[model samples]
Target: MLSWLAEQRIQEAMRNGEFADLPGHGKPLELEDLSGVPEELRMSFKIMKNAGILPEELTLRAECVTLEELLAACRNSGNANSSEQKSLESKLSLKRLRLQQLLRERGLENSSIFTEYGDQIRQRLSGQE
Candidate 1:
């Protein structure tokens, strides 16, 4: 019964684009239609997607970094070849560094939040378990 409910929800989410999934591969979440979530929360999801989960085609190495770190990384990863992206990357690097420092200061650097960044990012940023 519960599984059926879960499946129904998944189907509904699929229709609504509220949830996205990859099967045996990384598929970019179609976040364009997602609504209700705050803008910052949505950004967190992008960070989660970039750092840990690569789009199935890219297959970037899996990472374990907080959403902030991922966001920072994404900002830094602004396609170096693109001048505009390079500028964004520079900004991201600075923000990423600051978050890293914050994590260290809070002593959460070595904690599960940092160690399990990818998973936590998925859960927290995506509002999923």
Candidate 2:
């Protein structure tokens, strides 16, 4: 709805000579529901949170960057850089956020995955369980 409205506004502004260059109309995007993510992945999210991000804001979607990817992104620079570890922390944190987001949407998960993960999951979710 916002995208359509923005488009209309842009068109009107152009017709009225009220605008020459348009600011970003912004990319149209749908907020994905992460509630359906598998239990294992959510556990991974918890792992990320343990590393430091607030889980609630990130959501449980696996679409977020993974630990492996973070390592690679960090390594893209020829020389091994200490900053890579820090980047890993940020990625893990976001993944945890996704997990927390999913947990909230599901209204509290009682999956065995959490049981298996045990303390690690709890620690990451900020005592959300």
Best by TM-score: 1
Clash number for each model: 2, 5
TM-score per candidate? 0.32, 0.29
Segments of candidate 1 deviating more than 4 angstroms: 1-81, 122-129
At residue 1, give the lDDT of candidate 2.
100
lDDT of 2: 0.58
Please provide, for model 1 over 1-107, each residue's C-alpha lDDT reduced to its tens digit, 9 standing for 90 to 100. 99999999999988986644546345555545334333444576567677885432112112222333555555676453465555655665665566567556756
CA lDDT, candidate 2, residue 21: 50
lDDT tens per residue, model 2, 7-108: 999899889977545564455555543354455466666577568764443333322434645576667867767876777777777777766666667655
Candidates' C-alpha lDDT: 0.51, 0.58
The C-alpha RMSD in Å for every predicted model, in order, reads 14.6, 13.2
For residue 65, give model 2's deviation from the true position in Å. 7.4
Worst 10 residues of 1 by lDDT: 56-65
